[model samples]
Target: MFDEKNIWDTFRYGDESSFKLIFEQFYTPLFNYGHKFTVDDHIIEDALQDLFVKLWKNKDSIRETSSVKNYLYKAFRRVLLRKLSYAPQVVGFSSPEDKLDFNFQLGHDHTLISQERLQQIRQSLSDALKKMTPRQREIIHLRYYEEMEYEEIADIMQLSVSSTYKLLYRAIETLRNNLSNTDFLLLLSLLSLKKV
Candidate 1:
């Protein structure tokens, strides 16, 4: 596993290899995380690419006292928010269907998912997530899927630590209420069974 501090130090010292390592380690997860906010693949791709480029250009100025993952996520969130504000026309459409395929590709477990069942579960989860407010979904993703600390999440989300915990608590309650037992069970089963 890459030590985020070591990688950041290397990058700060002008090591090209460390930059490559960081990109390879984070690109897919960052892109998938970005997709939760928008269905446009190009937008997600562009946002992430731009973030990486900016990181590379500003490596010397970067100061991180926390995990590199937290830093990267915060940067990605900033880029996404800026894009959302700057290009409202590109991001304002509410087409849940547009993100369905990407959601499946990101979440599906090949070992557990037979072709048909995979498609069904993907659609189900995508629809369920679409029903959530963006903040709720973001809190859930950061807390559970990303396995981030509440303090780290609070920093990224610009909230107090207590508020982050409250947000996650409320989000989980909403998810539980909206998702049927079978769907919840299926998701939990997949998570437990899969290596992802």
Candidate 2:
């Protein structure tokens, strides 16, 4: 019933309804994704406005992509980065973690696991995640939380496919080294959940 290609085509044809539909469907996810880059909510909102403006203005010239989400994300990232590039040095922090925050949704569905055990695992996983570099955390969030493919993740992050794979591999390895077997398994289960 939900046809992305049709919606994208309609949007490209300058249908305001299609644009509104796309905006409603993607705004929250885009906002969350942008939050990973900067803490300022105002800046993120401004960037989204700019992204949509450009999307509508240049729709006729935009190339068709297999995934509309991918196209939007790539454009959004480029716009946000360009805006940040000219901003003050105070915005350009030395550490990636300073700009990126890692607060995974990590909801609790206590069907199989006890609440106490889940809490314990959450705390341990949080500690292990803190050990990873911000880029590593970003990859993990894109792969697991966003449920994005490696290629899409690579495109969004401006990395090669193999580099994205290796980055995720190293991030997972870091978590494995830091967490106990049980905790690692629990974390894996949490990561496997579909984003709701």
Candidate 3:
């Protein structure tokens, strides 16, 4: 029932209600998308808040978006990249086990899965993601988790559209190979059944 165009128009016309609506709709998804990049919750929170504040301040200059979701995601990705550039070196992976541990802790879902299964699935995905280069993981996160267009991702990562596609293709192949070695079929079955 939420009309994105109407909401944008209202926001452009200085309507607080429309801006509030947009924030409410996108807050969680954007947070989750940001989490896929960094383990720091405070950093993610600050980034999202700053991104929305900027959106409101620059409302008049905002272009017509084919998808509001994509617009928000692109903005979030840019903010995250800027934040990462300045963050401490400790933010980078220190070890494979450390990365896996952090990722498992970050993506663990208590409501969606039993603690044991959550740990197992989280470890599996974490290990797979850790095997990927930082750039590849960033691209995959932007494309799949954030749902940005390839062109937008290319602009964000400073790569050509074809290069972005190739990066994603290779990342997917790597993920498939890594995940395939685990109890991936069982995990998928559990995920599909909502019993994970």
The best candidate in terms of TM-score:
2
Q: Report RMSD (Å) for each prediction in the order shown.
A: 7.5, 7.3, 7.4
How far does residue 98 in candidate 3 sit from its true spot (Å)? 4.2
How many residue pairs collide in each prediction? 0, 0, 1
lDDT of 2: 0.79
For model 1, state the Cα shift of residue 91 in Å: 2.9
**What are the TM-scores, per candidate, against the unseen true structure?**
0.75, 0.79, 0.70
Q: Which ten residues in a row have the lowest lDDT in candidate 3?
A: 93-102
Instruction: Please list the C-alpha lDDT of all candidates, in the order they appear.
Output: 0.78, 0.79, 0.77
Error in Å for residue 1 of model 3: 1.4
Candidate 3 accuracy as lDDT:
0.77
Q: lDDT by residue for model 3 over 1-196, one digit each (tens)?
A: 9999889888888899999999999999888776666777788888988998999899889887777876787788888778877786536332233533333345544787688777666767777777887677778778766677898888767789999989998888888888787776766777988963
Task: Name the candidate that leads on lDDT.
Answer: 2
Write one digit per residue (lDDT tens) for candidate 1, span 3-104. 988888888788999999999999988987887677778888888889988988898898865688888888898998788778878753354544544333
- Residue-level lDDT tens digits of model 2 in 1-196: 6588999898898999999988988899888877766676777788899999999999999776799898888888888777776665535323344344556455657799787777776766776676787678778878988899999999998999999999999999988887776566767877886443
Residue 161 displacement (Å), model 1:
1.4
